[model samples]
Target: MRKLDEAHLCESVGDSTSTYFMKDQKSVTGLYTERQKNHFLVHSVACLGTEMHLAACPLEFNKGNATASCPGGVLPAVVSCIPGPLYTHSLALKKKLKTTTSVRLKGGTHQGEGRVEVLRGSEWGTVCDDRWNLQAASVVCRELGFGSAKEALTGARMGQGVGPIHMNEVQCSGQERSIWNCRFKNITSEDCQHTEDASVRCNTPYMGFHKMVRITGGRSQYEGRVEVLSLDVNRTQRWGLLCGEGWSTREAMVVCRQLGLGYANHGLQETWYWDGSNVTDMAWSGVKCVGDELALSQCQRHKVFSCQKTATRFAAGVICSETASDLVLNAPLVQQTVYIEDRPLHMLYCAAEEDCLSKSAAKANWPYGHRRLLRFSSEIRNIGRADFKPKAGRHSWVWHACHGHYHSMDIFTHYDLLSLNGSKVAEGHKASFCLEDSECQDGVAKRYECANFGDQGITVGCWDLYRHDIDCQWVDITDVKPGNYIFQVVINPNFEVAESDFTNNAMKCNCKYDGHRIWLHNCHIGDAFSEEAERKFEKYPGQLNNQITRK
Candidate 1:
């Protein structure tokens, strides 16, 4: 039976008398019934080679006598075995089951550190902190295409998890293919909580490269002044600024990627805007990069490392990104705050000096026409991942003595009252705005402000809320007659600053007026609804008789 099994025989059939001639007496002592004998032979042969079922294996029946019929009238039965293909289907199935699962870090600014989550089946869940250590974390780091673990964190340092706790008390030997292959306890509701979620900071090679160079004084990681660390003859490490006299976007790309911030948007040679830091020593100068190097140290530099000007103002800055920022208007505030007011000509001197008045106001005689203003509040928010910075630097900002502030960009928002035929009846413009963080979400603090000569720009996760009471937040509608018109407000109209999207920057409202008062309703975001929905919104009948008067 063992030899037949090794031969890969599928099945065999024999009569009961054939068992007497077997070499091993103990192996072939089954029941003597014809059906039972046939079943035993078939099953024994099938189970020998690859454990195949009897029905799946080929069977050969032996009906002829062994010696052409015994001479003494005693017939001898023959035993025959047949072979089939080997049963090796489990090998392919095992390979299929060994595919790696998805893994990622959550709530981290960069890629190498965060709360660890593994995708199981269809849901993504967190790992518990029980017995979590660097050995287990190394497996996770390697599984995620990074290096070994630098630190295995606990107590939810990366923020709390939201889904099920997939694993607990994980014990890895530091050589497993994945964290899943390591021994772990299956988690139950009582086993863990999100506050005890396991996290890891992987030891990435790029991190060492990033540590060799850094950016400082900018609002976010994407935009900052460049600084590099140098080792002296004694092997002492010191941080110093890079001379920005000849810095270009090509050089900036290498700096940003070396710091793991993706690609470069703009490489600034003179970054007075980011000069808030006090590090002023210049180390390397005349850096020439092809934009493909992994580290700034690999780039070409001047042989003598001399700088024409060593001031911090000549420091290099970079704007790194995979995409640009996206600016959007707060549509609800525009509808609720629309009103018309009359201002005397004497109060319009500041608006005229800042160029906030219409084009005709520039040529108007002194103190002649009273400016009729259509005023509303606007809340512009930077919803992108990066801050919205002005393209112009501090030197380019125009100082307005009338408002006592500097305008960074010439045109920020556009206000227009259009006729039914889309002709501009009266238009208003907001001069270069002083971008500041008016409010922010929870856990975020305001960083930029227009007051006290502070840095002006909208930070990420922050909004600039222009109240209705602020000066010059009105449209000079003094030239338009009392009639129905389309009130449109477009934020970031000039696109002087880069943004991820510009399609959602405009908002429109239906307006009706009778010279003394005005009514605005059905204000909505320009890109929030479909074109058909917008057409329906515009087709709604306006109540021209109703007027909400404001003094």
Candidate 2:
């Protein structure tokens, strides 16, 4: 490993050709001069000399930052290992873009650490999570297929990194990345509780759901027009028959605290009239958005809605409704995951479950609307963004859909239903999400908006994982930017069975011959659709097509 006099070394070693003696003794400075240098063969030594010269020539001769460096002068004294050049730039690969190709921009939640990867124009890459730890890494490990459920892992980074993660002012928690990776605020390193937060990007997969519910009834209504009730409103399936019969007013909010933004403002006023049918009236005349104090008094709620102190821009109390505006509200839909114990069934004939077999059929497929082709297209994107940019992920796509057949007629038809004893039959047509059940709750009328975002498919059927629990809304991985994106569902804490005889139909009307008269119906998914809702659906019907349970 050391240098020696070329004469003594080459002679003692015998095979001068095999030993690479330094022709220039000046090359060996750091080690003992009398020491013998090791080399495989003359040719191998010569090759090594070449590489060494290339690596060191720059350090020895290159002008500082100047491009005037000259070629090297070769010699028989083959250089050993050459010193590295002053500097070198790293290289990364890039490629073309293909569908289904996604990269993790950021991720790490629940006291877990996350890592970001790059898929250069077309090349795949890895990163060094030197600061990663088990405490905040479950999401990352799952995303990368590293571990089933992230367990405590230990090791220094053993891979190269790409792109930039801007972790400069960040600090790690002895875990991975930095506490900030989990989207948590910077805190004292040693004095925090076990529950920590982090931030991440991209890569949100469809996991499971947190909760689901069937809304019931409308809150307010209008006049002249006939109000009709659909089979079952609570059941996410049945579809609004029409709004002519009546109008109800009420709003529902399903919240998932983890996901600061994921929540449902169902039965919103904006949604009530999104469908093409003519609504008798917008019942949510004075309802306010639940969160924003300003919007609370703006959305037609009877009273001003109040926002929680925590949320400002949002009506923590305010929510968007689809009563009288565009269909865009209907476009934004929700998806989730769940487990159905038994395929929804019905025992009684009063529109319990199977009655509403006729759901809004899938749109007629066009020549260019092949399922596979559409799978890779942006139709889902445009639809989703319009629908609410719903959570994106596997089993996730924008499916444009609508349910319920419509009927329009005179007040006599509705007037007859209200007067008929067991003769719920009407004389003319009616308007409502559904006709059979025209008991629109006041709260419901305020919420039943018919916005642009029409019916979109959601998380459905997961009887395999969880029994008696059915809600696929939480299956969206899109918009699930790694860091702290939450998966949540709100379940009814009470297991009490509900019975209702209310119709879920309500509306406002203004005709020349007859003045407007507000009507209401009953169903689930509303304030009136409670455990006390006596046989409302008993006369109405429901079906899986509605994407929900019975009244």
Candidate 3:
């Protein structure tokens, strides 16, 4: 390689003939030149960008010509051909939404990290991790409205997927418009599994959105009263409380996303408990969002701020988390174990002591009459990135004499029977007395145990079992009439624990009851069906209590 002459370099390098020297794959604008060592001069070279080899282009070597030969001060030519789309930063990329075609990301806790999936025909499939690289991942990120990829994850780092393997051994020049534009091999049955799925972590642009707002007060940075930057009458920048009226999880979702927090654990209507900040004026009001906006400003808000609750305590607040546990029930196990039990009052001493029976049970004949109970085993699994832990630690755990155990969370799960219109017919709640890993996936060691007052939690990939025979695990249905009902179980019903996804936390089953016996069927996760399918499944035109607000 030889250097071009500085004097004539400008005229020679960027000439009309230089188009042949540039990689002209649409994104290429022009050649950018730089200096290099060990220079050799070449004249009249035409590459046309698609040459299989440098020898294919017409070129002449300056063997003995003094003018064409490298001078002592001259340097070799080095071109840093940057793509046209990349000249501008991410703000420019957001101006034009790039079409993703068939590629999609899945199972990611955050926005830019996920297992790569591609839609072929009507089927969605994963990409094999074979020969996956940052260049290929960058192509994916850029196509999906994000910046260059930060990491090319392999071996299902995000999580395994269930589908056919679409592509493998993908090769990219790091400038392709889409992953499909890159060279890839066809996948075979023996080639890969869901465990070998490819994933990517993208480098998102810093929007400084977090700086525009902040959470003040609360025990940690994740929980606080919401405050936004506003201009006062004097045109001075000030931080003021956000109005809490009509604020819900949807609004908080936008706030959490804007702050770069993982998710909204709770959208508190009032934050009087967190009094860390002195700012008291209600600066913004009438904020409502569909919930997918990147920032709070993007959501619909009032043109003129009007707040009914002007008190500082009435200010909006939020609890955010980077990672949270998601608990899903074993629906099949529940269906298999559901049964009705009529227990005599003599055996109800322990049940009555624990307050597990219905309210009407208090007036029942002592040690004589029997109470009808609906029993079912619940296998609550933590399928999230983090363990399902109690919000309160061990020091605050309350000891229960009857069960001979310490209850952690006030209420962990809700068991309810609902009519077709979404009205609750009966209800039962399980206080988290012993939240420990009763079972774990193969090769995964259990991290939580209830024995000897050990730490209590449902580790990721583990489940805590509450048997049907357990004292407080039954719903009292003695006063109920025989009819068709929806048996619903909601884990973490109060949002006491942070979770990556709360949508899948509920399981519903269709229950049929007669005067003598009960039947349960069609048990499944709440989000197991599509929106259209779910609407058809419930039949009744009422909002499901288990659904989380999403865009």
Candidate 4:
């Protein structure tokens, strides 16, 4: 039995429904001991209330080669779901959310210095700044648990700037452009622009996501996939992929011509007969095949010193090929198996991996690590709510008291790389939206009305990304294909709004209000700052809309 590896990723049977139908071993239901001394005492719950039919309980050893003693062996009443140290979750009150100093509230400031919402129980409620001073800022900062009072802000709301803006006069020793800006509030707004109302933002540092590759080997790992071409079944695929200069048996060289390697265009061609007669890895042009009964095995071994593919045929050998396990080499018909071994080898970057010498090689998109949380330093305008009333279809108006939709650098990868020359933005858009969709609604943002919502069979681009709201769980990524990237795109975040949000069509039907379009000439990651921010913005946000860890 092989031990579980990190790559052996598994999702927990998260819900009661799944757990109810599942076997006990799939989860650690209740803690079990080695033995049970007092059967009456152990089985007797609440004394007299205990059910008598102890034998009927589903109390049995979960798996083979494992056992618990008698009374000590009995299972506990609850699960032992402690991952690390048994640290119990506690309620923490903190006020680290503060906006930068440069910008100020544009209008009304009639309340205290500023207003803030605190997490009380399960709800977020506003806190009144009665003291309204440096002390108050300290309380807010300490409440948040970031550190001492960095600064305090007055006037506008920090987050969505919805509901009401309370808290009047406030002043703090905290620096300018911080949450400690005012000790008192001279402005007021039922719900106003970000400048007039506070947009409580906190400076969370940058964290980037990078795939971790642990296993690198020279030997090929066989993976089976079905390829659809101009014809349904054309067992033949033309191949040509050369190991870049210094890679072959020769020393360093810039170009292929620099080395004595043969055939440049048609780098290398490998043929595999699916007919069961010769479809073995050991028999492949560049590799040695493996067979059953090692003692009697006649398979020949080929040392792939340094060569590329030229041309190849796909034929099947033996009636039933000696194949690997279900994960890697399971073929359409077990008979259609292809041979690939996992020997140490250097992995190639996408540009190179695209052309593997193995004709049967198929690629998968790498898993993007996790996302870092950061605040957007922005000057937001006031917008009234969208008196949303469900329309004929399953669509409804999105009443955003103050919502300015924005887009990010939306990077998407497929399990299998999409065709470069001819892939649509729609497919990529679907993948991006599927991963990025924070709302979880069937139709978020009107089903990609934007020109770049990603078209089918076409290369995907940035304009295609939807405004995914918060921490997104790519939980089940059946939509993702692992392999080389189809390409990349960066849509102008501001200008692409009306195009992206379905529930939001410029009410009067115009985009003059799209303020930043002037700064973003062509929807590419504009400046160094924006580029850095784009890289930091993650698919997921913190649970409490709190700050993400700064890497």
Candidate 5:
């Protein structure tokens, strides 16, 4: 009984199975069902005609059965259809429909913040900064998935744009979705010039090469030592320390943004407070930034770099804001792919060395028991505005001969099968996962991959999907008996990495087992529901579980 736009609808049903119906009827009808034993069914009908308003009555059905059924047989639902055709065609059929135009930022090294340009009739054009403002610039920022405009620049601040100046006197109310929706004047050759080309510094999401950097060694989350991961000519990912020489607030600002933290309160060239880790190899020196760039690589550096202080004590450090990095589990995939498999103990030597098995496994006889593993596909998405990189460098990454891939972080994700009272019965852990773009949104390309030891990290608008068949993606539940339990998955369990919001990081599902086959339902994002609803979800034992709720 609610209206939804295409974008919101896609997000809501993204993890669920859905069906769409399109018919040449006067009205469109829909039926929705809630996931509960005694649920409500609301039926709605709307007009199919474009630009026509129609009102339909909502019919509510009260049912005792879990599945929806028509008790009184098929009811003839009627709606107040407007007296008009489905679509209205103008008499001037010769007029062509407006073709879609494209926008891009040039000159700047990063995406979202750059010189303004438009694509028209297969030709790229520019915008004249006659009356450009933050309002107009924000429209472009929003269209590019950035937050808003931080600054609306003019006089070729990001360098002059080439080709025709197609727009001038641009104005926006700041609420428009795109620059095309705003009011602007079409320009001729004499109306405007490239010297006045408009540029925008958008409050864009932290992305690109900046994702490969991390901060460590500080006492608090805000204050930390600095490190970076880079790819060598050999295609091997390596992590090394940074020389603190010439490090300033400008460089710290980029670091804070890359880590999803706010602006830098203090950038330190030398810090003896946090030298706990063994990472002392200096890989960069003479690092400089403009305080506006997204990544350190975008900053200026000396052609031939060397560090005066070879010690890690002189490494770069920064005190950033409290807010950074947020990780969340893919709830839909857990419910759909959860299954059980039996693995031999003889084949678990690498897992044992990695401490993936429980402490009890150490005391058991060598290669004795068959571990009943609860396996499922997990898609850990970096939904926050910034990328999530491992805090450790490649020197510390563990290479598993059996897996043939390096583990980047010591502890990345935690999986557990807990009793109703919150008692843990079985557990699993994923160590130092390699980040890659399993999928990305339109206009974005897959950059990082684990293949060839490439740079590994999750970029904004990208996700790292671990299939159900992958090694160590399961809980060793060989000891648990047949009963009701809660299946919980927590991403970035250790506070080693920072995130913007940590509330949505945990996902839980209701599970039922009977020695052989198992069923998981009611899977949902941890913070999506209220505390009371979560308490109810955890309290109820899965004796007669039948519905999967979508919140």
Candidate 6:
């Protein structure tokens, strides 16, 4: 997510009715678990699923311990319910939804995941991955009577299809019931290939997967230390902690999915601060996943109980969210506008004040030396549903005496030059002095402006552009040796803001420096290519550095 500051993103929650009916797993019940001193044990609770809240159910609390209220294997109530779809498309698209005979999914392992194919006339075709996103994929999901998309895959992730490419650059508002109701570009033969076919994983019916695992000691329902319920050799059920060692976002993603949480904002490896759970037995360890698993138990793990740290403070935890912003840099723009500028120190007063130049500049003669700056334009687009707002409000914005503007965020972006092994050679940053809508789509009116101390934020369908001429937009590479390197631009590098997908927040380009000049090529988003292609890119040989950079 291209966020303005190092803080968790937040959105206001409004009262709304849930779309699906849900029930807990019988194996794990409320009455069987450990309880706090002040916690109540409600008994004989019964009500139809249609009730808005548990308060509507006939409930009675135990006067003492849980054993006194419930006995004879009478654990907490285990309900059986057939859940409906978690979401539906807009009612305004009712008429268009009926005409969804055009689109279909294929080659899926399950019902709601597959390569998206559309019918052009009577012949089935596929969609190009260009500009394909969750918004457009959600439309197709709802059209197929499923919930919103869990993943909008690209580059034929579900497998390639053989047919004409019917659509390119699909743009949907996510409210449309069908992909046909959204704006799109007609595909040209040269515009797309079968290799770029789009695919999706839509949200399916509730399966009570969340009941098997849970988060405890979080400030909200979306965050906490992870605990899983599993049976021992004697078939006795117990809840235990997952080892924090080697835990990462991929593991967190599976946990969130299993828990019916939207997405994993953070895969925290430590839970020392969350004091809610006293369970300290490390039941699992060495869990590794590719991030598409439906359950944590399905992930690869060590056969024996093993952990570097067995303490409860080292338990795996997660912070989940229903929505988050996603930021993508304009790769083509970065390639088209990259150049070197030997800026005189006298003219870099503002840049110096902002600490944009390399640290070696401090030892140079007063306003005499020229700093070789690698300049490029950065265009950050918020592709997520949530607006990208500054974590700190106006009251906390820091004023910059030199720039004569308020710095809304401490660090908005990071521009770096990295070696082949991914060690940083040099770096620069764009402090968010002004974050406003630099431009918007055709129908998206500008909602943020930096002029006259106006509201600052990048709304959906809008972008914030930092031109090459702007101060602090370039990495100072004067002290570095000229050789092959990677030019990487990381948005929200600190993960300060919550984003739907942090994997795509980085844009990288192959760079070759030859003392006097620099060349950049193959600039693309981090997740734009396949794993194999990315591996080859990372291991790119030095011999290939002689080629002319693409314009």
lDDT of 1 at 31: 16
Off by over 4 Å in 1: 1-320, 362-365, 538-551
Query: Across residues 186-268, which tens digit of lDDT does each residue of candidate 6 receive?
Result: 86779888678999998776555678899999999889999999887789999989999988877887887777676677788
State residue 30's C-alpha deviation in candidate 2, in Å.
Answer: 76
The candidate maximizing TM-score is 3
Cα lDDT tens digits for candidate 1, 285-393: 9999865566788789987778887888888888888544557788778888888878777878987777667787877777875777888888887655567777778
Tell me, what's the RMSD of every candidate? 20.9, 27.9, 9.5, 27.8, 25.5, 16.3
Q: lDDT per residue, candidate 4, 220-311, as tens digits?
A: 21111111111113554322222222121111010111111111111112223222122122112232222111110122323343434322
For residues 1-551, write the lDDT of model 2, one tens digit per residue. Answer: 22223211222222232322122224455333433343211111222111112222112222233122123322223334211111111222111211122234222222122334333222323233334444334334333322222242222111112212222222333223222344433223242221122223322222222222112222321111112222343553332222111112222221111222222233222233222334332222223223211111122333322222211111112122221110100011111111112122221121112112112112312222211100000001100111221212213322222332221111101211222123321121211221111122122222212234332221110000111121111121111112211111211111111101011112111111111112122212211122222233323322212322221
lDDT agreement of model 2 with the native: 0.22
Counting clashing residue pairs in each candidate, in order, gives 1, 211, 7, 124, 7, 0
lDDT of each: 0.68, 0.22, 0.74, 0.22, 0.67, 0.74
Candidates by TM-score, descending order: 3, 6, 5, 1, 4, 2
Q: Looking at candidate 6, what is the lDDT of residue 465?
A: 95
Q: Pick the candidate with the highest lDDT.
A: 3
Better of 1 and 3 by TM-score: 3
Collision pairs in model 5? 216-225, 324-499, 324-500, 325-499, 325-500, 326-499, 409-432
Query: By the lDDT metric, which is better: model 2 or model 6?
Result: 6
Ranking by lDDT: 3, 6, 1, 5, 4, 2
Residues forming the 10-long window of minimal summed lDDT in candidate 5: 5-14
Task: Give candidate 6's total backbone clashes.
Answer: 0
TM-scores for every predicted model = 0.44, 0.17, 0.65, 0.18, 0.46, 0.56
Query: Which digits, one per residue and each the tens of the lDDT, describe model 5 over residues 321-406?
Result: 63333466778889999998888889888777777777777877788876778999998766444566776676878788766789
Model 5 lDDT, residue 5, Cα: 16
